[model samples]
Every structure is written in structure tokens, then in C-alpha cells.
Target: MAAAASLSVMVLLCLAAVASAQLSATFYSRSCPRALATIKSAVTAAVAQEPRMGASLLRLHFHDCFVQASPVPSLSSLILSSPT
Candidate 1:
């Protein structure tokens, strides 16, 4: 049982490494050319409007990433429900 568990863990770790290797920092650069600049500008404007909003945005982002099962839907809900 112990050996089986160890092998399972090793397999999971190797799979995780392989999955992460496929990710790239510039993955969206070509598909969405201005995505980063757009995000930066929006964030800058939002923070400029109210400095505390930066913290709130970060917290929402964290929740979206870690707490939500589906990030896209959670993020969409957040955006739609947010006060404009």
C-alpha cells in the first residue's frame, strides 16, 4: 500500500511538471495582442479612482483563482455584479 501511494504521488508530480512546462508567460501576446496593456490601463484607472480598490481587486482575483471551481464564470459574475 505504501509503495503504491508513493508511486501515485510520483506520477502526479511528474504530470504536474509536464502540464506546467506547456505554459508560457507570453501565451496571450499573439492571440490577444493588447491584453496586458488593456488590463494594466484598466487597473491603473481603477486604482486612481480609489486607491483601496486595488486591494479589493486583488482579493477578488485571488478568490477567482483559488476558491472558484470555474474561473471564467466566477470572473464574469464578479464583473457583472460589481458596482460601476
Candidate 2:
């Protein structure tokens, strides 16, 4: 009985992993840490180039991260709208 239970659990886990493997086009960052730093620094330096663009990108990333981390759509949207 225990062996069957474990096997069923393992099968479910494998299926879950397989189901989640698909990713959206935008999430492909070859170097995530470097990309994050680049985006942050670009915004920080945007006091000169495109002021609003930097801020907008930062907000978009923050929101993107939140949704990816937490799939509860309504909660993510509400938090995204709230003041940063």
C-alpha cells in the first residue's frame, strides 16, 4: 500500500512539473541577475535619458515578478495598482 501511495505521489509530481514547463516569450532572460541589475541601474540613471521610461520599466518588472511568483491573478493586479 505504501509503495503504491508513493508511486502515485511521484507520478503526480512529475505531471505537475511537466505541466508547468511552458513559459512565455518575455520570461527568457539568459542572465537573470545581470538583467535585473541592468534594468535597475538603467532606471536609476534615467534622471538624464528617459525619465518616465525607466520608472515604467521598473514598475513593469516588479509587477511581472509578483505575478510569476504568485499566480493569484486578482491579488497580483490589486497589489500592482497600489502605490509603490
Candidate 3:
């Protein structure tokens, strides 16, 4: 049961990554580059903190966080993305 939930989470994260790649260019037109840089750094740090995750998974989460910051991609977009 736990493993099934984990697989579901992975599927959702992959979907978010694809969605983010599509949304990022549209949303960042007026945004400051420095702000984006800060977000990217924070995401990298948060992903690095996960002990059980492999490097590729950590990188994917960081990439996803660049645009899909919220777990569900809405009001909480300021928060970093997390991988299960």
C-alpha cells in the first residue's frame, strides 16, 4: 500500500514537470531574474536534504520547483516542490 502511494506520487511529480516546462516561459516575462535565481537555489537546497532520493530525482524536483512550486500548482506556488 505504501509503495503504491509512492508510485502515484512519482507519476504526479512527472506530470507537474511537464506542465511547468510549458508554463514557465509564460509566467516569467516580467519577473526579475534575481528572484528566479533565489527560487532555484532554494529548491536545490531542499531537494538535497532528502537522504533517500537519488540525484536524478532530486534534480527533477528542483526543475519542477522552478515553475511548479506548489504540490498542486496553485496558491502555494511560493513553496518549494517536494518529491516522495
Candidate 4:
């Protein structure tokens, strides 16, 4: 059961990556050189604080991609539109 869930998350990530046109390793190199490392650090910190947070984030990503056809703006709107 856990393995299947892991595979589902991986597949969702791959699908999102493929669907995104401008997505690339160096997408933020010029604009935000430390973006990847910064994200990694944050995720590491969150996971260290609570392992389930990692899975929650992955699920969030999957839903974001599933609901929003586009990546950045839609996801941002989806998140921001929520009542604080």
C-alpha cells in the first residue's frame, strides 16, 4: 500500500514536470540561483520537524497540478484564495 502511494506521487511529479514547458534544472539559475537549494533546505527542515509534512506537501503538489492546468499562477491563486 505504501509502495503504491509512493509510486503514485512519483508518477504525478513526472507528469507535472513533463506538462510544464519552461520547467528545467536551470529555470531559476539566472533569476534565483539558490532557489533549488533553498527549497530543499526548507523541505528538509519541515520533514525533520514532522515526517508527515513531507507527504502532505507532495499531496498538495499533486492536487495543485491536478486542479490547475498551469503551474505557478494557478497554484499561487489556489493557495492565496484560501481563507487565512
Candidate 5:
């Protein structure tokens, strides 16, 4: 199970790198002007409250992507939904 999860993460990371390469620097500027700043502030506050929260959040994201068996999940959906 651990190895499978790790492989999933590796595959996703590689796909993300390739997909990100096609995105423009200002891709979200017109669609969501404050998106980056909002994300940065939220992450900064979470990490400041608990340094380990950063890694925990990342692990949760990966788990959401690969561990869920029903109702296919996507990173954007996970980000928009309640963390609990």
C-alpha cells in the first residue's frame, strides 16, 4: 500500500510538472486576480500556527488524490472542499 501510494505521488508529480510548463505566468491573473496572494496568505498563516501543518496538508492532498475509492477526486476539488 505504501509503495503504491508513493508511485501514485511520483506519477502525479511528473504530470503536474509537465502540465505546469504549459501555463503562463499570468494564467490566473485575469481569471482570479488575488488567487496567488490568497493562497500564500492562507498557507503562511497555517504554517505559522503550526509548522507541521504544511507537511500534513500536503500529505492530505496526496491521500485525497490516490486513496479515495469512489467519486473521483481532483486537486482543485480537494482545495475547494472542507479539509475535514
Candidate 6:
């Protein structure tokens, strides 16, 4: 039983690794050639405006991951909102 449990854990880890490996740096290269550079510039500008915003962005990522089904949708909503 112990060996079976160990094997199960190993299998799950391997599957998770494979899943992550499927995400590539060039995943959007063809679709959006400047995506990485644009995101980097935006992040730099944001952090320049507010140093703590970098950590806040990370916290938002965690919050979206835990509280929402997906980060993109929640982030998109936030991005698209207009200030009152």
C-alpha cells in the first residue's frame, strides 16, 4: 500500500510537470509578437509609479488563482473597468 501511494504521488507530479511544460515562452510569439516586451514595459511603469504595486500584482495573481476559476478573466475585468 505504501509503494502504491508513492507511485500515485510520483505519477501526479509527473503529470503536473508535463502540463506545465506545455506552456512555452513562445506560446504567443506568432499570435502576439510583442506581448512579452509590452507586458514587461507595463510592469516596469507600474512599479515605477508605485514600488509596492509589484507585490500587489503578485498578491492579485494569488487571489485570482484561489478565488476565481481563472486569472485572465478576473484580470481582464479589472483592466476593462472604468474609474468612477
Best by TM-score: 1
lDDT per residue for candidate 2 within 23-71, as digits (tens), equals 6555636646377678677667875686687667767789877656764
Pairs in clash, predicted candidate 4: none
Clashing pairs in 1: none
What does candidate 1's lDDT look like per residue over 29-71, in tens digits? 9999999999999999999999999999888889876787552
The true-versus-predicted C-alpha distance at residue 2 of model 2, in Å, is 22
Give Cα distance to truth, residue 1, candidate 2, Å.
21
Candidate 1 global TM-score: 0.54
Candidate 4 per-residue lDDT over residues 12-77, each given as its tens digit: 667777875656878899999999999999999999999999999988889876766554344355
RMSD of 5: 12.9
**Backbone clash tally (model 5):** 0
Per-residue C-alpha lDDT of model 3 across residues 3-75, encoded as one tens digit per residue: 6655766777787778744456647647665777787777678668874455666677687766567545442
CA RMSD, predictions in order: 12.8, 12.3, 13.9, 15.3, 12.9, 14.2
Flag regions of model 5 displaced more than 4 Å: 1-26, 69-84
Question: TM-score of every model?
Answer: 0.54, 0.28, 0.27, 0.53, 0.47, 0.53
lDDT of each: 0.74, 0.63, 0.61, 0.74, 0.75, 0.73
Residues 18-74, candidate 5, lDDT per residue (tens digit)?
865566889999999999999999999999999999999898888876677545456
3 or 5, which is superior by TM-score? 5
> lDDT of candidate 4 vs native?
0.74
For model 5 the local lDDT of residue 69 reads: 50
